[model samples]
Target: MNMHKLVKVLAPAGIAATVVTSAHVASGDDGINTVEAAESTSSNYKYQGDTGYGDGNFLLNEALIKTLEEDGDLAFNGHTIEASEDDYETRADKKSEFVEEHDQKFTLRDGTATKVVFPIQDETLSIDDVTEAYGDDFETTESKNGKYETYVYKLGDKKDDDKKNIIAFKVEDGYVTQGTIGYSKSY
Candidate 1:
């Protein structure tokens, strides 16, 4: 090749190499590195592994709920579904009129058994007993309506769906009349 042609080729190649090297230096990828490590804080919330009812082992499907209402021995986890009620809500539309809306119904109940396996032989269980069984790794919320005071215990998050694992105890005259342990709407 002629000297002039050789000069043109070599000059551009050298310039391109310098530009690439400079770009690498400018972009901060030159092997020296700095990493800011972050430590995540632990949550105070504790989770229960057993989850009382048969929830830890099997899901409480609709059929099981029906069986609980119909038969007395079909128990899951440690509780049985005693009864269910349809929930209704009042809603207002664009008009000034209010309408009644039906929401998901309450589907299960413990009926005063502390994880009591069905064929509930003896009526000897109490809500306090259930609370004691759960220990300190739980949260409680209470509400009063008429003659009944409801106590809800939030055990932990559910494994199958986006719901809370809870056990509700309905008390009247300082005695637990009903108990329910199952998944409920999170919010």
Candidate 2:
């Protein structure tokens, strides 16, 4: 090929690369666009991990949102499906995933047995904070076996009460840690 032809062929490639680069810059892949969009929006509030992948400042295939809403699971973190009444949110996750929203309608009560599970945190939680969440009457129990300590609570009063709540707290090294808080059919 002649030198002139070779130069012409490379010219188009150069222009294409510049165009792509400029497009990314204009769309805020750099710091400028992020600042612009965030300032114009909700005062740039920060979440734990907001990656700006869900921005709507530019035109996009918005039909993708509906498709994702109907079909997507919470495979990725922070992804959740809002409930119809907005009372709760469903977070589909793995075994070890930390879920933020779950509509646990059932409460623990008396003459009932409930199994509870929670992750142990650095600090120990007192029974007062735990008791506030459970409106029912309950008693903290210690087992003779070298096992977990339990707090038994009642959901309601009277023999006609159909539901009961029991909470067993898992303790480690003389400290109350984490445990499951759930309602059970068997007492």
Candidate 3:
């Protein structure tokens, strides 16, 4: 499922729902997929595991994190890639070459790109749309190293008080659509 569909199916943004208390699902063969988003941590959040790009494995820079502190916890709004006709069945099979693509960027609260092209998958989003939404205030990255094509964007506050969240999409031209949200308290 693409990030767009994941956001809607798992975490519906309606009537002000709070952070998830707990959940356990059983995905049939497709892998038990769950979208973790929406709720702010009741306690301080912490950053774990390196983003693989840096110490925290996070893609955002020091300056950008500082900026989000001035605003509310950052939330990412994505796009909708309609799956073919009214039935959601894709007529065209997804091309494997899509992995060779890449893009990345960094933006501020007002939505401006300060950096771009680190190459992460935005199957749930388009780089252009992100550029417009984040402008020149944030940073982005892209890469085709994984089994699946991937593009990404990263943003948030200081590592000690993380308020930023990540929204991502998984693209596979034909079979299914999905999304994933990664969050941290950033201590």
| Model 2: residue 100 alpha-carbon error in angstroms | 15
All models: lDDT? 0.31, 0.30, 0.29
On a 0 to 100 scale, what is the lDDT of residue 123 in model 2? Answer: 40
Error of 2 at 7 (Å): 64
- Which regions of candidate 1 are displaced past 4 Å? 1-123, 136-144, 157-163, 183-187
Instruction: Score residue 53 of candidate 2 by CA lDDT.
Output: 27
lDDT of 3 by residue, 33-147 (tens): 4444334343121121112122211222221232233333222222111211211112123321111111222222122211111223324334344344434553323235544
Ranking by lDDT: 1, 2, 3
Indicate which candidate wins on lDDT.
Answer: 1
Q: Any runs in candidate 3 off by more than 4 Å, and if so which?
A: 10-30, 42-125, 138-187
TM-score, per-candidate, Cα-based:
0.29, 0.29, 0.26
The sequence of per-residue lDDT tens digits that candidate 1 reaches over residues 111-187 is 32212211111233454554554455544445534666656544333342223334455555554555454433321
